[model samples]
Target: MEQSQIQNHNLEKKRRRVLNKPLRLRCSVQNYNWGILGNKSHVARLFSLNSGSHIDPDESYAELWIGTHESGPSFVDDQFDCLNSLKEWISKNPDVLGDQVLKKWGGELPFLFKVLSIKKALSIQAHPDKELARALHKSQPSLYKDDNHKPELALALTEFEALCGFISLKNWLGGADAEQWLPVNEMDKNHELEAVLESIFSQILLSSKDKICQSLSKLKWRLNLEKKKRQLTDKEKLVLRLEGQYPADAGVIAAFLLNYVKLNRGEALCIGANEPHAYIYGECIECMATSDNVVRAGLTSKHRDIQTLLSMLKRRQGFPEILQGLSLNQYTTRYLPPFEEFEVDRCILPEAASVVFPSVPGPSLLLFISGNGTIGASVPEEQMVEEGDILFLPAYMEFTITSESKELHLYRAGVNSSFFQAY
Candidate 1:
């Protein structure tokens, strides 16, 4: 063969080597302070079960990462070069990323898949859009890791609650919340909706630490009273809960400003880039772009970019759209957000049942949340799969899963098919 043809042959061989089999993976675990402690954390339970590693009962188990993101990369269990992370594997065989993703994001994966077991509220934060992310990364490389924007979807694994976007103008300045949000009404007596919100939020952002502590004490005292406790709205109750977790923090009081969203199991909410939101409580499956850049304002001791967060936030009011997922088959329901970065699917198979996942144009990660099954790939090979297991499937690979004793629940993470349609 000629030199050019020889290079093509070798590249094709590398692609076939990676695409022919499923990779059983061991993912990284993050222990954030806001996570559930010990065995109570779903992240811990799954990580220990999957890796056979010791679980620290006193330590918090926060996030189980299942991707090639540098923050917490996954490792292949069955491969001989087990020391190399999935990130390294992808670098060797970039063709595994598929044409659409490889063309757009180069050698890196475009999305990060995670299981978050939250026991307390995460930082009241917002992610920047592409333009702002690029600027921030250029100016502050240490703080902002990547130029990629982080637009995430939070799917409730259990009953999940969060502070998302701003509440309606009427809700903030009238009715049951009028007394609690008295300052907002006082600050913006003459301004329109967005102006009123800006003035209120700006004041909160600029408040003295002493004043915030004092306000939190007063709010708690009032809510603890017999009369107020009985009539506490969902937002008010969340305020009290957040105050309990983060005493004297402004985010506790921010409950009155942001919409309190309650998502039941299997429901999802997508927070676009530059939207101000926080995960308040409960367990969830979170998927987003592979970047770890977050601009925080309050609710934690993390670094704050108050000015950047304030400037980037979208002031739109009203609750976020709740996605119940579209049913693709008897066993699968897909929660594909409007963002092109990610598409998540929930699959449940009853005892002695099977489900076929068609070939995809991009790489994918399959998380077995519960039960046991056997996964059959192309040809006559079968692999045993169990609860807490994670499998990485390369591009253009199809597989069928059959549940054994009980119902099998799993989450499949993939890129949106629209990216490949052009190719």
Candidate 2:
């Protein structure tokens, strides 16, 4: 055979090998100590698989990381090397590494997976849009901004409560009654708070510290009085106090804030960037595009950037009615966002349900949070995966999962539609 033909044959063979190699995704779980704020012990334990004395019964077991970003790169083997380090491997052996993955995805994986167990509410926060993130990162390269839009989905591992997006201004403001005697009642009918608080939020934007202080003052008074009298119910008092501290927080205005959502075992919530939100309680399997640039406004004592966060906030008022918006298959419920870089889905397989593989061609990560199941992928035939086990399926690979005990609950993370189209 001619030299060119021989080289082409060699290239094709190498491509097969690289594509066939399975990437072992990384898992991170944080644990929380009693009364300790910002305690990510569950995340730490899940990522490290450390079962120390601090492990709580309510803590999350694992958070799977499948992307090539540097925050927490997935391991390719037990050796524990980052997937980003594989760039040299790809560059040196381009023939083995598919040209498409290299050219479009830049030799890096695209999505990140996580499972968060929270005993308390996460900070009310928002993420920057792509342009803002890029600009921020450019100005402060040392900071964590990476110019990626992080649209995330969280599936409840247990009963979970989260403040997602904005409640309709009408619903929020309408709930505020003049006779209610709340601080908000002090405002005149013609005040911006009264008008903008009830309509679509786009009509006005909160621009001054005075406006924020005024709203906050009202919330504080109500909360303090409620605490002293103990007249409000337990849930009511918690939110009332939170609202009092951060009255400008749109999440506090959500009706969901007043009520707790009991996600039995398989329910989920999807949150997009700049949509004001907060995770109130319960354990959840979370998945998102590989970025961690958060601009927190309030709700927790973490970092607060009221101005920057408010600027990034998508102030359009209306509670997202997403309970029934997802696309549901027999065993899976897919959360599809407007962006295509990431998609999160919940798969609840019955004991007798056929364990099928995902159809997506890009990298995929499966975190088995519950049930005794057999997973077939890079391993021989079928390996038993338990509640804490996490499995990684590389591109174009197939796998089967069968539950041997009770129903198996799993979260699957994969590249969104945009990744494939772009490639």
Candidate 3:
């Protein structure tokens, strides 16, 4: 068979398999361990919109997952259609998985996408790298859970704040109150980051309860004193906030060791494996490699794996880069991260504009953030989507989105060759 004939035959097979249309998948909600309490969260509102009902007033809203990762695989209908079933169908019709993704990931959707609503601070935590993840899962299945590495991208939907990575060495050691850290100042500059961090963190965690209380009181007094004189640094403000929320818990001091990051709407931060972080407030869309293993340090009532967490720290310290979307065209901004597991694009359509996306080589998950829109491969075949709605686009499926309101906002998540080209 000639190349053109092979291509035409493949196209026919794909049309029969996927029909060039988007499928409205029912995403599942997760309350998880740490999340904003009550119905005040945007997550709750979004959930209500998607399910066509109100969320319980007392239940905390956390995450709405739109993938097939076993933890919270999305369904296709009331029959509880699973993504695994979709995978099975794609296996027989390889064109629906596309040659690139099928060849690389064995037809698996390699990312987990989420919308997070945080009303309070999450635990101080870090995710293990791929190799560490596998070993930990094998040794401690209950705690480690999965064997995949989780390198995540957090894009702010509303004003957001988080503790990400470590502060620069100069800032960590040369601050005005540098003397307070004692041995941190005394340690050799040539020591390994693991040794340096382990030494300091161990001291903080091992401090007596009375010492912790005393330190907390002293920090409050100094902050109040500084308030009368000058503005507090970002780190100072974060320390004060954590102390207020956690009282004398050692995590209050841990906050000082990490960089405090504040992201305005549309800004983002890519969290690499072994980087310590915590979401402080507001809502964001997060994407990660399909893993749930986390080693937490503090600031919560949950179990703290101090030794494991300390061991996992990257040891290399620096500020994390905040990302801005690269405009793909007039209607979309692609927020490309350095990792390959996933990339997100924000599509902003004006009142009457319509955008056509040609068939992509990998599957995509779309989430409706605001406004109303109609999605279809052909005008006659479409579905109406409003806030909180989710659609799964199989590979080789071309579709168009038309805004039905004054403005329509949505996010698209997928993985591609771009993932391997960058960090």
What is the per-residue lDDT of model 3 for residues 331-415, given as tens digits with 9 covering 90 to 100? 9888877787788988989887999876667888899998998887733667888888887787767788999999999999988
Which is the winner by TM-score between candidate 1 and candidate 2? 1
Give me candidate 2's TM-score against the actual structure: 0.72
**For each candidate, what TM-score against the reference?**
0.93, 0.72, 0.87
lDDT of each: 0.86, 0.57, 0.78
lDDT of 3 at 381: 63
Model 1, position 315, has a per-residue lDDT of 82
Off by over 4 Å in 1: 1-18, 185-187, 226-230
lDDT of 2: 0.57
Per-residue lDDT over 1-423 for candidate 2, one digit per residue giving the tens place of the 0 to 100 score: 999999989877765554554444444333333111233433544454422234454544334344455665544442323443443444444433234544655655556777666655667677777788888778866664587767777777667776666544455445532224322333344566434443322211233446545655565576567668666644455566556554565444332322234455566666777877777766666777668788775555555666676567665555454443255567777766555666776777888675576545565667766677777765465666766566556566677777777688877777665557765
Which of the numbered candidates is closest to the native, going by highest TM-score? 1
Q: Which stretches of candidate 3 lie over 4 Å from their true place?
A: 1-19, 32-34, 37-39, 78-95, 177-198, 206-210, 378-380, 419-423
Residue 375 in candidate 2, Cα distance off native in Å: 2.6
Clashing pairs in 3: 340-419
Model 3 collision count: 1
lDDT of 1 at 376: 90
Candidate 1 local accuracy as lDDT? 0.86
Tell me which of candidates 2 and 3 scores higher on lDDT.
Answer: 3
